[model samples]
Target: MSGEFHLSVVIPNRNRAHSLARAVLSVRDDDAGAEIIVVDDCSDEDLSAEYSQLQAMGVRVLQQDSRRRGGAARNRGVREAGGTHVSFLDSDDVWLPGRHDRIRRFYAAPGRDRTVLVSGALLHIDGDIRRPHQPDWRPGRSLVEYCYRDGGRVQTSMLSLPAGIARAHPFDEDLRVNQDTDLAMRMDRAGIAFHIDPEPGVTKEESPRPDRLTTGAETADLSFAWYRRESGDWSPAARSGYFLQDRVWRLADSGRRPAAFAALARSLVPPVSPRETARRALSMIAGEGLYSRLRAGWRQRAPAPADPGLIAAGERWRDLDARARAFCATARDAAAGQPGTIQ
Candidate 1:
């Protein structure tokens, strides 16, 4: 709207057209004066109409022909952005209408600087909004230290970075799933401070998108690669840390029991939580195999029925389990009909 915008919202999208529209709309409503860029990663979906639609609404849609990953798309958007602060939105995620205004205030608060990366809580959904997982992230620590200490996640949608620092470190294009984590890790290793806005910002709809998860595995590989860049190698200790803790669950879901077991073993060293160790061991023993077990668990109804508050911010794991199952049914069906579907 003016000569210079305070924030540039970068959204990377694939085929999730409807969701993208809703996300862009939310941003526009909240941060009307901020610059918006929709980076299309060559999705087959007819987003031209959507692009035209957003452009009419004052959003800048950038087309990226080569589909590398979310990291690459985000990097391109940040590189092309013309704002002092950059925020990201995934194609399938939506932001609360007031998220931008709130975030801007958080960034402009006393003591805020370009060196601090801001992140907040993420609410997951599956046609129904799930409760926010109060991520115990502290503002004073470096991002890597946060990871080591709390094992928290920094979703791209809920994070805002200063343009100068964002330019210094771009998202890892090679990583599709965990690039955000990798970038935060890189930033942490480099002594950049991260500030967590104590509020939920992005809502993610989680379903069993196997390719997305496999893309996540590729991301894990790239994350390990990024770690190698920082720490010389994925230290057996570090590998067993948060990164492999996640991979063990994935491998378990993929039915790679032995590998998952090995990973679980690898993850059981110092700094590993006893609860997490037990959880991984039990997961391996249960023969849960990802979706099947998840669906089996999710099929059960919630003891406390969905209420307005529950829908907006419910933490009942049972409720989440049920919703995940419902969502996974469609995903499992989609994966079943399609061969070579990464699960």
Candidate 2:
């Protein structure tokens, strides 16, 4: 294995042990000498068997005695990572094939350095619905503006940066939600360069776990607070867009209609973009289900261009999904004293 740019894949897992193996398998590359670390956030269930399986596959597992959430777990992983570049993957999400090659290519390119943070598009899967999330950032646009005003997004699973930079700028541990956004904002403010790869690199499965942080009722409140904390350095238009579109939309989705309306009213103080705000308000009024279908339909009209890399990634994801289901079924059968052969 060449030592030009060793990659460390850090996966922060809580209680999602069933899917953790698949996540680990997605990024493991013995030939490339990629380091894989799984940081456990004080899971309630017994994970000894899972840890043993991961350890057998050469994954280094670390468990926290207390629950510190994903940010802290990720920080611990970064601190423990020994590679030149570090990439993160959630336990429920899996990186598609060619992600490591993409990272290595980015790092090997001329004019790239440790201060560069690389991200790629993600294939977000929610049940029968699948969509590709690609950021539309351009020159002279701040990360905040791209995210708020232009509908650009960057998830943790799609992020890869230098270990030194990640250690220097750790995630905000106290944040209950939107940690990815907060970290990106801080990195942008600190003059870290961002590079986005057009290829879809990860398959981010929307886990049905009810205790997931984003599904909690307090997500709106936490997101609103996060917006207020980070929007101070943003432009008025960015602020308005974030408040009216992001925060208010989240609030309405969480059934906080009164608070959402109040926030929408507040976003019109200087009237940055009345049309955008009105559109968001109308979307909220139309209900999430209808709006989601409409948005999906709109996206379907202009589908992403077909790429061989993306097509291979999707094929790999389906294979991994099948393997994960088979593994889970076998485990369950084993626990029930039945024949546990994986067919």
Candidate 3:
């Protein structure tokens, strides 16, 4: 078993015990040979039973004293992992059956770049799976280039970078939101190529309840400090973030718009390098157009009746369902000619 373990699945989980159980169960059911590590980030709820269950299935549980953010937790797990390749799974997301097997196969494929990170599909699911307004990825393109050309939304859950790359470019713990995007972009900058499988490899859970959206935004805003720190570098990821910040401003209400605008204004400042400045400008423009279209399409989709289970879940765990719903509603109204009212 030790000799055969070629991949390590690192899952950083906080207080979401139930969701964590489901995610780990998905891996256990797949019977994948990868070593599983669940890093507990000072969760208030005791997850001893879940730990025992995972251990029974050959998972290693690492407990951390401080509640470092998820990126930091993932970094800690990678340090403790023992595999040739490393894959990340968010606590709320699930790997479809055979995801690990498929990823390993991609790695083993002839003519594939061993140094290149491989990723595939990520279908967003709330109560039920719904198609994203925009394609998560394009077919047969360099994942790194795709991220560079567009804004980085590469699903880290479906990504498997070589052990060396993961060691060299761990997730930026300083970022609370958009950290995955930042990490992916950094990997690309570090010269890691990427291959994306055309099939769905993971499920990203989306919740559309009101309070949930605000919380998501708040948590997302926490990463702005990190963004400010990296503002000197106008990488594709940073440009993507700039467009994202502008959209955030567009969605901002009367009071928040000032702050949002201030952030966007800051992004206009050029990075020191000429190449970086040009890349940043291109990324901002590209991300803006893409973000606009996607938001428009989301508004076009018919809103389903609010799911009570989702709302209840939002209530219990400060889920993003409400916020997602609100965003959808605004999009819908905007699609129908009523300008979206920012919250």
* lDDT values for all models: 0.64, 0.74, 0.60
27: Cα error in model 2, Å: 1.3
State residue 290's C-alpha deviation in candidate 3, in Å: 23
TM-scores of all predicted structures: 0.75, 0.82, 0.65
Is 1 or 3 the stronger prediction by lDDT?
1
Top-scoring candidate (lDDT): 2
lDDT of 2 by residue, 290-327 (tens): 87688779869987677666566667776777876666
How close is each model in CA RMSD to the real structure?
7.9, 4.7, 12.8
lDDT of 3 by residue, 258-289 (tens): 55545454444432234434443443455645
- Number of the predicted model whose TM-score against the real structure is largest: 2
lDDT of 2 at 246: 67
**Model 1 Cα lDDT, one tens digit per residue, 160-237:** 877888889898676645677778777777877776766667666565466564534444554455556665544445
Model 2 CA lDDT for position 317: 71
Ranking by TM-score: 2, 1, 3
Q: Which residue runs of candidate 2 sit more than 4 Å off their true CA positions?
A: 29-32, 132-135, 207-210, 261-283, 289-314, 328-343
